[model samples]
Target: MTQLITERSTDVIAAEINAIKFQTQSMMLQASSEIGKRLIEAKEQLQHGEWGKWLKDNVEYSQSTANNLMQIHTEYNSNPQAFGNLSYSKAIALLGIDAEERENFVQENNVEEMSTRELQKVIKEKQKLEKEIAKKEADALKEKKLLQQDIQDLKQQLEDAHQQSTDHEDSEKEINRLTQELAVAESKAKKLEESLKAKPIEAATVEVIPESVQKELDQLRSKKNESTDPAEIKFKMRFESLVNEFDLTLHALDGIGNSETKAKYTNAVHKLMDKMRATLEGGMS
Candidate 1:
């Protein structure tokens, strides 16, 4: 029976100790909140430039400590009941979180049950995660902007290509029309030649042609002389054909995406240009 009594007394003593511990913690939290509140009031009442001096002389506190207390008061004064049992160290550690989120964080993580170090660590990790997520979101937004710009550029290029294709079709149609006109002119010229050959020259008094007709004949003779100039016609035709071929080559080059192949083609064009330049220089000399 004595042994049983001793065991029960031991259990009662342990419960009392736990209760006292709880009460002591609560009192400390209340004291801290009160101190913070008084600090805030004192700071507001003090002169603008006298805060640091007042803190140092009157309260024997550093500027940092005073700032911390004022921040704590601002964050916790309104709802001290929610955090009445928190220790001073834990409250200070929890200050890392925003005031609105602090209560929820404490409830969710059971911060009251955790050590100050653990709470600080958890807050640090949360801050790091938030930073990482913010950075990623910013990067994603930047990439999205860049992608949109690229899309816009591609759209403009496509529109330009469509316009160029329309112009090419028009040029082809013009070339076809000119070719048809040339063929008809050639057929008429052949018939006229045959008629002239079949007609015999009759002796008659010289008849004066109209001034407009003489002028027309003179223009035709001049045009015939120019057309029969072999070197000039050959030079013009060769130059036009070469220019067309070079334009086609450039279009083909634009289609090549491979850097190495494009570089090779570019080098070949450079060499050809150098050779042409040298030939032209020799001819000029």
Candidate 2:
């Protein structure tokens, strides 16, 4: 029974110690919030240089320690509803987060129940995850922009290709039209050539006598018709036939190849015709 009582007492002592530790932690957090509030009030009332000197002289706390305590309280004191269960150290660890984040962080990680070191570790992991997510989002946005640019480039290329195709089609049509026009022109030229080939060549024909030569022939015919003597009539008829033969021979001279030969032949024929004309005139007289 004595042993049982000793065990029971030991259990009660442990519970009391735990309770005291809890109360102490709570008091420390409250003190931290109160200290932050007092510091703010003191700074408002005091000058900067005077406050620094007074803090160093009157308070045993160093500037840095005071600032840390003040920050911890500033972050959690006003919003004690969320951090009421956190110890001063644990609340200090959560000061890295904003007021809005603090409530969520406490709920998410059960920060009130966590040790200060544990809370810090969890925050570190959370920051790393957020950083990775931000990097992925930035990379995705960059890729999306690049994809849009590529699509625009492809669309421009397609437009250029389409324009080129249209231009080529127009060129082909022009070429075809020109080819058809050329064919038509060639056909017309060929038909003209064929028509020229089918027709007979114009023969070398007799040229018309000069007007002066025609008047002389008319006078000669009138004189012949007035002649009554048989010999005169015979001479006149022979003279007229000779003149017609001379004209026919002159027209035939057009076929001569050598100009010198043609001139010599023409001169000889003129001399012979002159003698015959003189003989006919002597007979008529």
Candidate 3:
């Protein structure tokens, strides 16, 4: 019999709970008459923003408390074309028993407060933030353009400098090449002159150097013996020696006497000496 008593008690509690829920739902539906006009007036007063969506979600969650709000949320969400379907009487029917219940619902579910000025101020702040973002974007674009131009100018300057450096190097190399060529030409000219001096090549002329003429040449060869007893003879002898030495040293390479013809140098010297002797004898007399 103890098991039977426990089952009966459980049944009684369950019935009481069901009855309480029904009464609660009935009372909430009755208050909608007062709240219906107020809710519409609030929605119309403020331009809808995030708060509109918040209100809609809250109304959907209100299903556990009452049925009217849940139906409204479902209808609004499903059929966007079915607007303004709320009867003030129907919304008033959905209002709960007292202000305490409404305040608790608002607090727990984040019901938004309705103020046009506050909503408008928030919108203005958002717009200001958007404008600041646009300005920052424009400034960054301008800075990027300036940086790109600087990079371009640096590239041009680098190219010009490189060209100048290449030109300078080419010029220096050319100058060095020309200098080397000139030195080579000068060296060739000097080598030719020295070869000419080293050569003991024969001239075309054949001058006979007889013993008597050679001995006579030796006597009058020195510059001191050039002045003899007679001033005229001394002058003539000096002139002859001067002519011969000048021919041998200065004009030896010029074609004068050739191999085919010969001068009897001894006979000429004897003749000159005899003339000198005559002139001296005449002077002494």
Give the best candidate by TM-score: 1
Tens digits of per-residue lDDT for model 2, 214-256: 4764564344223334455444445445444544455456557
| Total backbone collisions for each predicted model | 0, 0, 8
Which structure among the candidates has the greatest lDDT?
Answer: 1
Ranking by lDDT: 1, 2, 3
| Model 1 worst lDDT run, 10 consecutive residues | 200-209
Question: Per-residue lDDT of 143-247 in model 3, one digit per residue for the tens?
Answer: 345435534543554455455555566544434433333333333334334423543323222222335654654454332212323454445445444444433
- Candidate 3, backbone clash total: 8
Worst 10 residues of 3 by lDDT: 200-209
Candidate 2 Cα errors over 4 Å, as ranges: 1-8, 45-54, 166-285
**TM-score of model 1 (CA atoms):** 0.54
How displaced is residue 268 in candidate 2, in Å? Answer: 99
Off by over 4 Å in 1: 1-10, 166-285
TM-score of 3: 0.23
State each model's CA lDDT, in order: 0.63, 0.61, 0.42
Q: On residues 119-142, what C-alpha lDDT tens digit does candidate 1 reach at each position?
A: 889999889777765664454355
Global lDDT for candidate 3? 0.42
